[model samples]
Target: MTSTQEEKAEIILNLINKRKTVPKGVIYHDYNDADGSIKMQELQFLISLLEERGLIILKGASRDPILTITEEGLNFPGFEKQREIDAIAERKKEEREKLEIKNLKGSVFQVKYWWVILLLNSIISFLIAYLTKS
Candidate 1:
């Protein structure tokens, strides 16, 4: 029986996770086929697959990193959780930003209330002086 997309993705993720370092600088030259360099392409597709799951990350072209498994990404209970975990993380970040924006929009800027604060301080000072004089 042919493996599902999930199965293929899981195999790749497990392979990378077992490595001490996922070769962040560049994929090994051997990983690619001599012909069309299709191995690199396949690895990239696999990377995208895991990223979709939220289990790995590849950032900065300068580094040309391979995605690594995340500890919290275990929730992708399925075999291909790495791909799911990335999406989950992204959605969670988006939600947090949304909630934060809502909170920010609900309140007025604190610096703008400086004049009101000054007035309150002036009133307290005036009352203290009056009591001392009395």
Candidate 2:
């Protein structure tokens, strides 16, 4: 990793490691302090760094849309906050899936349009030939 990336990872690790408990949202568990795993915008970047460095693992959370860390991920050197990092990883994956689904829908619509055009052309040609011959 580059020096800049390593530095950012350190920042994220420190913030998450300090958490005594986990609550909800992207803020601190205490709910008073602003300190947390990352600044709102940096959450995605932090997750990428964690995965790229093999600092965290992801497991499925009880909730359908959430993910938790698996048993295999106990602790990783350099990155101390496993859960926070895993959360980041899961969030990024969700975002990627959403975009892929959107693209798939668009592709399906394009294919459908092409098929409809072909069908219409064949029908028109058939009708014209039959009428002209008659």
TM-score of each: 0.40, 0.30
Q: What lDDT score is found at residue 95 in candidate 2?
A: 100
The best candidate by lDDT is 1
How far in Å is the alpha carbon of 118 misplaced in model 1? 63
Candidate 1 structure quality by residue, lDDT tens digits, 13-119: 55556662476424434333222343555666767777775787665563477556776444446654545787899999999999999878655555667788899
Assess candidate 1 and give its lDDT.
0.62
Error of 2 at 100 (Å): 50
Clashing pairs counted in every model: 11, 0
Check candidate 2 and list the clashing pairs. none
lDDT of 2 by residue, 1-134 (tens): 55655666565544444542222232222222543334534555654555455544333442211212222322554433555788899999999999999999999998879978899999999999999999
Prediction 1 TM-score vs. true:
0.40
Candidate 2 displacement at residue 10 in angstroms: 1.2
